[model samples]
Each structure stands twice: as structure tokens, then as C-alpha cells.
Target: MAGYSLERLNFLVVDDNKHMRALVKTILHALGSKSVVEAADGADAFKELRHFPADIIICDWNMSPLDGLDFVRLVRTGKDSPNPFAAIIMLTGHTEMHRVVEARDAGVHEFLAKPISAKALYSRIRAIIERPRPFIRTATYFGPDRRRRQIEYKGRERRKTVKQEQVVDQSSVGLSQAEVEALLSG
Candidate 1:
């Protein structure tokens, strides 16, 4: 981590507030990031993203027109998205757990509350570089896996077998389907 420099990485900062954007840019520059672009809104950010190669995106949640949520959903699910796997970090004052969940479900790779410090920002960037999460696709979601890692977890299987599931769904007495449904409904 001592030798890692962010100068080679490109970043897109999206926020409606000019002051916030500048503040983030300054922080990034101070942290050894030289290639940073600013966007006033998510739409502009999305455009900039297509034209520029961004390794990470630091964006605000609330914005006019295309907000951060919209931008992430499009990027994660859109057919013409430039890079579906681009790492994204949400930096905003909104600290509500539901908002964080929304951001995570929308495909954001990281979340940082407002009043961000240089150390925190640098730590997040380093974490992303060091331990990028694997992407997952499901019937209802498409994004990086949301599970928190357990240290030294060696692929323990947790899924139940088909026969086990079938047994659990039914009963040992071999009750009729209607009888089971009636008992469950009660």
C-alpha cells in the first residue's frame, strides 16, 4: 500500500454542488490522483464515462435529472453501458441504512458518508484495489455480491440438496397435497 499511486487511475466525480465536486477533486489530487473529471449530474457523468475511461466513480446520491441511483442502475443493467464492471463509490451525506442498501443493490462497490477525510478516502481506494468483489447475477439483481466476507472462509457449502428440500417441503406421512395445503393455510 505504501508504493501504490492513484496517478494512473482515472476518476469521475459527479455531484450537483460545485463546491463538493471541487473538494473531492482536491482530495483525490492530494492523494496522488492526477486524472480526475467532474460532472454536475449523473447524466453528464454517464456521458463522460462513455467518452473517458474511469477506473472508479465517486458520486453523490441526490442530483437533478439523472441521479446517482438512476446512473448506477443504467450502468449496471443498460445495454450500452460502457463498462458494467467499473468500480463505483458513493460519497454523500446520506447515512441511512436503507439508502446504503439501495446504493448497494444498485451496484455501487463502496459507500462513504459525507465529510470524508483523506485517510478514509485513501483507505477506500486501497481497499477497492486490493479486494475487489466478484460480480454476481441473479433473477432479481445484477451487481457485486453483497455478502460480507468471513475471514479465511474456504468455500463451505450451505445449499440444501434437492431431496432434502423436497422432504422439507412435504411430510414423512405422505399426506395428500390438498391436506398439506390446508394445514399450512391454517
Candidate 2:
């Protein structure tokens, strides 16, 4: 956290609740981010993405007209998508395992449950920057790799024909002192 900075990154925050959006923006600012765009829902978020060129997107799971899951799918596979490879973090109150799997399958780069703290948010951002997962493309899926850990598989090889692409290179970004302290002390 000593040598890294969030000053250069651009963020887009999409949530139905205005309060949540403001809180996320405030936290981003406190984390040393200087640029953040807000959208009320996923549909509006798509519009913002067309112009904002956001480096990372923090979006809520629940919203009217267009939810986070749908938005992530569009971003990952839509023909009109501005950036299919943009990092996405899904924020939600639902902590159910199925919901997390659903978000992961929809192309989310990270998942942050509701009641989010600055430390949790900062850690998610840090993970995206420092340890970007390679994108996986298959007949039915095209998004960040869903697997978070690498384990030795002693079984048969399934989907050997699937192609995995490295979309984002490993980043050299670091965290701010405040973020480091929050992560360490918590």
C-alpha cells in the first residue's frame, strides 16, 4: 500500500439506491480515487459506459429494469458493448452461495456483499488490479475465469477444447496507506 495509488483509475458506480451510490463514491474518494461516475441502474450504466471508459465498475445486484446480472452479461457479450473486458465488482445484500455463483457465471470479476466497508471495497479493487484473472471463453460462457484458486486436478480433463484467453495482464498497481492500514488492522 505504500507505493500504489488509485488516482489514475476511472470508476463507474451503478446502484438503484442513490445513498449507496454516494457512499461508494465517498469511499472511492477516500481511497485516493479522483474519478467516479454514477448511474441509477444497469440500463443507465450501459449508457454511461459508452462514454465514461471506466476502468472498474462497482454495481449493485438488485435494480429495476436491468439488474446487475443482466448488465454483466450484456457487458461481457453484447455486440454494442463498449468494453467487454472491463473489471466488474457486484455488490449485493444476498450472500447465498447460489447468488454468488450466478454473479460469477455472469462475468463479474469480484463480489462484495452488502454492508460493505471501505476495507472490503479496497481489497476487491486491489484484487482486480494486482491479480487479474484470465478470461475464459467457451460455447456457453465468456468472462473472467470463475475459479479463484488453482488446485491440482487428479481427475479427468473436461472441456479440453475450451480456449482460455489472457485479456488483462498482471497489474503493477498498489494500494494507499489508508487502504493498507484498513486491510492490515482489520
Q: What is the TM-score of each candidate against the true structure?
A: 0.79, 0.85
Model 2 lDDT on a 0 to 1 scale: 0.85
Q: Tens-digit lDDT track for model 2 on 18-99?
A: 9999999999999899999999999999999999999999999899799999999999999999999999998988756667
Segments in model 2 whose C-alpha atoms lie over 4 Å from true places: 1-3, 159-186
> Per-residue lDDT of 1-186 in model 1, one digit per residue for the tens?
466889899999999999999999999998889999999998999899889999999989899899999998888898989988889988867766667678889998777777778876776687678766667677778887676444344686532332443322111122234423432342
Instruction: Write down the RMSD of all candidates, one decimal each.
Output: 13.4, 5.7
Q: How accurate is candidate 1 locally (lDDT)?
A: 0.78
What is the C-alpha local distance difference test score of each model? 0.78, 0.85
Clashing pairs in 1: none
